[model samples]
Target: MSSTTQKHRNFVAEPMGEKPVTDLAGIADVLGKRLVSHGFDRAYIVLGQFLVLKKDKELFVGWLQDLIHCNVMQASNCWQCLNDWCSEFL
Candidate 1:
């Protein structure tokens, strides 16, 4: 039952070299801005956090939620986006 958005499709389609954090699925302007303010201004920085969390769904989702009050769906979408990106590029 898992699925993704066009955002997700576009993200995982290629190497995410130096892309903005907003380019990740579910990380729109507000979230991206917050992430940027926290010094996680890039996709690779967020990806590093993802790896630091060992790609664990619950941990990553909780981190996103705690960081910028993102909801479950948003966090999950971002997680899946990163996970899929890793599958292709990492």
Candidate 2:
């Protein structure tokens, strides 16, 4: 079987308590900083926005594109991260 990406494994490896958005895999340093500037400093805070969007893929993707210029893949990865994290912990 093929292995998962380090980003995927690392994110799923723990409770995300207080981890900064920058710490999330697939989020580049520039994007992470932009997210922080927009008041999404913590991973959990981004989780809040994810939940607020009710996990709708289109909405989430659109929001990310609008807010941070995230490409489709990056937005999708971030969405998956939050969705899986919620499934595990929320």
Candidate 3:
């Protein structure tokens, strides 16, 4: 089985609380800072948008690509992270 990174595991392992978007796997400092500037400083805020998009993978991925220039892998990872978090918490 493919193993998840420690960051990914840690993020999905509990409540997001106020963790920043940068805290998610594949979201580097530069991207994180940019997201914050765009009003997505917190992980939950991003999650809000994910839900707002009706959890549509295409929309979420496209939004990530447009907002942060994230590649498919990066966008998918972040999307899965939030998706799993919602499954557990929301």
Candidate 4:
């Protein structure tokens, strides 16, 4: 079994429901603050971007990397979190 982070599991286990960007996996306080400052205060906003990117991993990862300067692993984690959420909820 893959060793998923608790954060990832928690976020994917339920509806996003206006959760803060920080609630997403791999988005810690610093990154969350950066996202908020850039007008991505909510998880849905990021999900909107992900959908707009057509759910392409590269595009979504690149967008997050560009927007927040997150490392590849961090971006990938966020991508996986959103992807799993979509799989369950959308």
The root-mean-square deviation over C-alpha atoms between each candidate and the true structure, in angstroms, is: 1.2, 2.1, 1.5, 1.2
Task: Kindly list the per-residue Cα lDDT of model 3 for residues 40-61, writing each as its tens digit.
Answer: 9999899989999999888999
lDDT (0-100) at residue 74 of candidate 1? 92
Please report, in order, the local distance difference test score of every candidate based on alpha carbons: 0.93, 0.82, 0.86, 0.92
lDDT of 1 by residue, 1-90 (tens): 157789899999999889999999999999999999899999999999999999999999999999988899999999999999998887
Between candidates 1 and 2, the one scoring higher on lDDT is 1
Write out the backbone clash pairs for model 2. none
Residue 85 lDDT in model 1?
91
**Number of the top-ranking candidate, with lDDT as the measure:** 1
TM values, all candidates: 0.95, 0.89, 0.91, 0.95
Worst 10 residues of 2 by lDDT: 1-10
Which regions of candidate 1 fall more than 4 Å away from where they truly are?
A: none
For candidate 1, give the lDDT. 0.93
Clashes of each: 0, 0, 0, 0
Candidate order by decreasing lDDT: 1, 4, 3, 2
User: lDDT (0-100) at residue 36 of candidate 2?
Assistant: 91
